[model samples]
Target: MTRPRIRWHIPVFLAPAVVIYTAVMIFPLVNTLRLALFSKIDQERVFVGLDNFRTLFFDPIWSEQFWNALGNNFWFFLIHMLVQNPIGIVLAAILSHPRLRFSALYRSAIFVPTILSFVIVGFAWKLILSPIWGIAPSMLDAVGLKSLFAPWLGKEEYALTTLALISVWQFVGIPMMLIYAALLSIPDEVIEAGEVDGITGMAAFWKIKLPLILPSIGIISILTFVGNFNAFDLIYASQGALAGPDYSTDILGTFMYRTFFGFQLQLGDPHMGSAIASAMFAIILVGVCLYLYGVQSRMRRYQL
Candidate 1:
């Protein structure tokens, strides 16, 4: 019997990608985790085990900001899951209609924001929503609804929610495109079968199409979870690193940034920042695991 080839060429082809990933992603992640376990004490980096985590969670000065940022992050995620995903699904469903005219145009227009720079979106929206010069107030005034307009971005109660909605507006197109592709992939036979059983229109969607697209939705949910936790650009672009209105819009990303780089008079603390980053990594890891093992498994079973 001849021995199987070693497949040296396959590894040769994969080596560059592996090396780049290790250098860019794996090494940085491992280093961040390592940094989280040490602290600069008396100008020396000392191994401190979980002391950084302890300070992050239990130290009075740090705990409040950490918990607040965490709560805001949850709210941010909730808004995306509740508002953005549903809107995207609805848009996808509408555009996926067989006879819908100008569907491509609509898709392009909606998806345009997804490709725009976060800085541009943040700045543009800030201007459009500006109380003194924004068109939002003018449009409201034109419609005789000016009374409803307020400085949404400047208020503590509204700042976080406002930023969240802006983010939703910018990214809702992503899930729409995903779901639209899923909807389009539904076999013609399936729809015909649904019709034969009187499951037409919305009924067909709820019964047949939706079940088949559950996996896509599950994937989108996980993506949203991971993306929202790692979010920084939009918030930073719109609200600044301070995430002001008394830090109402501060999420873990901004919190970690402030700690890592130091803003204004606050000195940078890399150790604490690494701890925060590690915490974020852990949260995202757990979320992905739960979705993979629990939600994804159930989705597969449902599909089967």
Candidate 2:
């Protein structure tokens, strides 16, 4: 009997998607990286090698802002890792409890903010925290802690942290859902075995469930890292491109935006902007690599 011929139509089915992805994503990415190596000369594009990158890292005027923005971006990621993930895990644990009532309702309510546009969330929080509006101060007073109510968003020392926390509040649902799914995937028999082995309640979560959920936690951590580094919308909406006061909340994303598009007194510089984008891509690549090789590999070992 003749062997059936293998189908050759698979590539045809995937061709459109591949073509579109290349055009929209891959081509733009490659072009941007190429642009990073070129500079403009009297309205003409000219190759400049790594001069833009060198200036970004070595020139005093640019280096200061570059390092400052990079540091702020790391701190922003750290905050999400510390605050958001823990809160999400705890909320997930509580929501996953068998005894918990209205689980769906609670989940929906908590997740509502994540579905809102960054503009809406930013502006809404701005108004809610406005000193003139008296909402924040009044709410604090109702709780008998009025002195704790400061214009946190307006203070340079507090603006970044405040905005970071707001972003945390908005995005916490993602991790919570991810973790909740991980928890739900745990077999009842395995959980019962843990109970038989004297692991119950919090101990079960810590010793049994937590170990099984390490992979999901690692994924959440990496997602948080990427999201925090690439964050722009909330900061831009709330603090504007200047990232005031006096650029205290300026992160790489906003810095890249202002550099690329120009803001106020500054003229746009596409080469410098592309260099910044390339730097951001490098940072994110490094982070993902570390997570995959370091955190994820260790987690897999533990799972095995």
Candidate 3:
């Protein structure tokens, strides 16, 4: 066979990104993993193998908080998957209608919050939900539903769910945009084909459009999983580092931050913090892998 010329320019063009990624991402990740494997002993770092992880999982003090945080993370993720993604899909479906008026305005209004700063969203929501001098109660009272107004952010039972809904409100546009694009990418011929067979309206959507958007939905699910697990800023900004009323809003990110940096009088433990970070990494990695192997594989088979 004739030899092909090398595309030397490809690697040359990629060199800068490769170098920067290595320095910014790879180096830090490796360092964090390394740190997780060691602990401070006698004012010096010493190799402790998986001792930190052991403490994290089994030690009464750390285990309780760790498990609670892990559970909270799962709940946070579940809320997004159940509420946010479905609502986004519905919104996308509505907006994608051929005769929908001012669809552009509706899209802009919904998507604007996605681009807003998390800090701003968190703070604004906190103020609006405040029991005293807040609009939520006033608005509810105006509609004769003031009995439903409670200090949602301050209650342990409701705090996490409330925060999750706020997050959904802020970022639901992401899934909407993604699904909308996916819907638009469906060939006109496919819709016409469905219509010729007497499929129309909601039937057309459920049978035709939804099937074609499975891959996009799967992608959105994975993104929601990753994003929810990594969530921190909103909780931190709204509820402080403690993620209270009693750490009810705590997730892996906030837990790691508290452990790594220390809050108030609690002393920081970098090794333990790294261990938490490593656990978060493993959880996200395993979830993504499962989706790829379990979900994506099935999706491909179905397509075939």
Candidate 4:
């Protein structure tokens, strides 16, 4: 075979994106990792190797917060995976029905919150869920569930779970849209064949539709995992950087932010903060890798 000529224009076209990504993402990430390897002693930078990590995992003060945040983060992710994706899939399946009226309207209504700013969603929810002057109590009273309406966001036992549900409510549209697209892509012939075999309704979904969308669902799961672990904005907006109710709602993201930037009286510690960030990076990287190698490998994308 003759040698194929390399296209110089390929690099030329790719240069801008490569440069932008390196400048914005890769360089900052590398700098953070480097920062994690050092500490400031008496305002002087000192290389400490893995000492920060050692402290994070072994030292009582730091380790306590680290493990607490990690556990809360996992619980947050679990809640999303269990409640959010299933709800999205159900909504998508209903919206995908050929006879459904005003499907576009239902899709738009469901998706509106996903487009809202995190700050807006968080604060709006905080206000609505507030015990003082909030309508949630009144609404609950209307439904004869007034006794169940507690200040969920202010209670340690319920704060994290409440926030996770709020996040689920806001982002459910993402999986819905993704799975909806995948469902729409299924050829009518395949579905017709499925129907001919007495697979219709939920049966069609379980046997014909679900397997085809496994790849998309895997993608959503990974995305949710990464997003939850990296989550900060909504928590910060709703609960503040303190992640109050005694820090019961703190996740790795808020913890890293508070460490790096510091709160009202706390001094910023960039080195330790970077260490936390690096730890989170590792977690997200491992989760993504598992999804790709463990889950995605088995979910072969159906051609039909």
Candidate 5:
């Protein structure tokens, strides 16, 4: 049997997209990685191989900041995984219930935060949580829980965790919406079959609906991973570039920002910044690969 020759015009259809992708994404990524290989020596730019990376890992000053940021980043991701996702799942499951009254209003109210600017959310929360002249204390007083309130954003022990929870509160709508959509995509016939098998209500959800939505959960996990790792805006807007309380809320994004752009006492080092950027890229790449191979491979998608 003879196979037909591929069309020469095939490239024409892909040319514009390929060109744009290469110019906007591939080129910048390649250039950033290349920049990470070199260092500034005195007044001159010189190729330093992996010296910058070594310095970032071994030098006490740089390594301390890098590790601190990286550790905090992991914790940030962990909080989202533990608190944000579970709440979202519960909310989604509840919202997905058929014959629920005022579903649209509930959805719109819950999702309103997601549409607000991070700056607004961050600063607004900052003000609300402030120790002085904020309504938090008054509200607590009104409820007779005044003693339980503290300046969470000001304390080093609570700063990172507080910011993470704030982020979770602001973004929970995302996973809820995604999971809700996934739940809706499930065929009603499957649920009916579950009911016939005595798997109605929660049991039906656990056995039939949950398994089908595994792919969507996997996607949400990956999205959360990427978003949390790249998170900077909220922290920066509320806490400034230093990410105080003494950099407790420091993450790779803020760390890289400090390195890339001079802040207060430190002069900007583009090479080291590129190295940080490359490290972030490496971490995200590893995470995505593990999700794809480890998690996604084991998750079986069900047809509706």
Candidate 6:
């Protein structure tokens, strides 16, 4: 008797998703890169090769802005790493305590801001910070510290950092939830074993829990890297596309948007815009690859 032929159904199941992904993501990406090769001349697109990238990197005017924005973007990522993740981990630890009361309510309240629109968050912060209608100055005045209050979003020195901190406030809940879930996944018996070995409370967390959560922290780090680099909505909503105060807060996303769609006198330059986008894609890819090969491999070894 002839054996029945085996058939693979997994590809059949995945074909539609693959098609959708190619159509929505991969095709657009390839098209953008292709567009980067052409420049506009008298409103006619002309092949320019690497000219756009040359201008982006080597030209003093463009290079200065590019490097400055890149540096600021790195700083933004660093702030989230230093402040947001640590705070979230701490909150998660506190919330995970077996004896903690109203943990659900606390978690819900803390996470509420993450669901709000960037526009809403930005405008709400703007109003609260407005020197005239806002309560911030008055509240500071009540504490005799009104001198410290200023239009932070309007200041060149403070605008980017201020927006970074505001973003941290809104998204800290994500890390908190991830870490909380990771912490909960640890076997209770292992924790009890730690307790028996004279490890309890902070000692238990630092010695036992923290080690187990390193992988989760790595994931959080990479996620923060990608998110901070791609961040545009909060900055745009609060500071506008120009990232005002003379472009003090212009990250890659806003810069690319302004480059792609002309703002004011500067006509849209699609070629340069695509180059910027390609640069961003390259940066993100490098970051992800580093995390995957370096940090993730080490994490796996530690896990084993």
Which one wins by TM-score: 1 or 5? Answer: 1
**Poorly placed runs, candidate 1 (over 4 Å):** 1-7, 301-304
Count of clashing residue pairs in every prediction:
0, 0, 0, 0, 0, 0
Encode model 1's per-residue lDDT on 1-304: one tens digit a residue: 9999899999999999999999999999999999999999999999999999999999998999999999999999999999999999999999999999999999999999999999999999999999878699889999999998989999999999999999999999999999999999887888998899898999998988888888899999999999999999999999999999899999999999999999999999999999999999999999999999989877653433
Residue clash pairs of candidate 1: none
**After superposition, candidate 3 runs with Cα above 4 Å error:** 1-11, 301-304
> What TM-score does candidate 6 get on C-alpha atoms?
0.94
Tens digits of per-residue lDDT, candidate 4, 186-263, equal 999999998898999889999999999888998899889988988999999999999998999999999999999988
Candidate 6 per-residue lDDT, tens place, 104-205, comes to 999999999999999999999988888778698899999999999989888999888888889999999999999999988888888999999999989999
Residue 190 CA displacement from its true place in model 2, Å: 1.3
Model 5 gets an lDDT of 0.94
lDDT of 4 at 227: 86
Q: Name the weakest run of 10 consecutive residues (lDDT summed) in model 5.
A: 295-304
* Total backbone collisions, model 4: 0
lDDT of 2 by residue, 1-304 (tens): 9999867798889999999999999999999999999999999999999999999999999999999899999889988999999999999999999889999999999999999999999999999999999999999999999999889999999999999999998999999999999999888888899889988989999998898898999999999988888999999999999999888999999999999999888899999999999999999999999998888877753332
Q: Among these predicted structures, which one has the highest lDDT?
A: 1
lDDT for each residue of candidate 5 in 35-150, tens digit (9 for 90 to 100)? 99999988899999999999999999999999999999999999999999999999999999998999889999999889998899999999999988769999999999999899
Query: Tens digits of per-residue lDDT for model 3 on 182-301?
Result: 988888888898899999999999998998899999999999999988999999999999999999999999999999999999999999999999999999999999999999988942
Q: What value does the lDDT take at residue 192 in candidate 5? A: 88
Question: Which residue pairs does candidate 2 place in steric collision?
Answer: none
lDDT of each: 0.95, 0.93, 0.94, 0.94, 0.94, 0.91
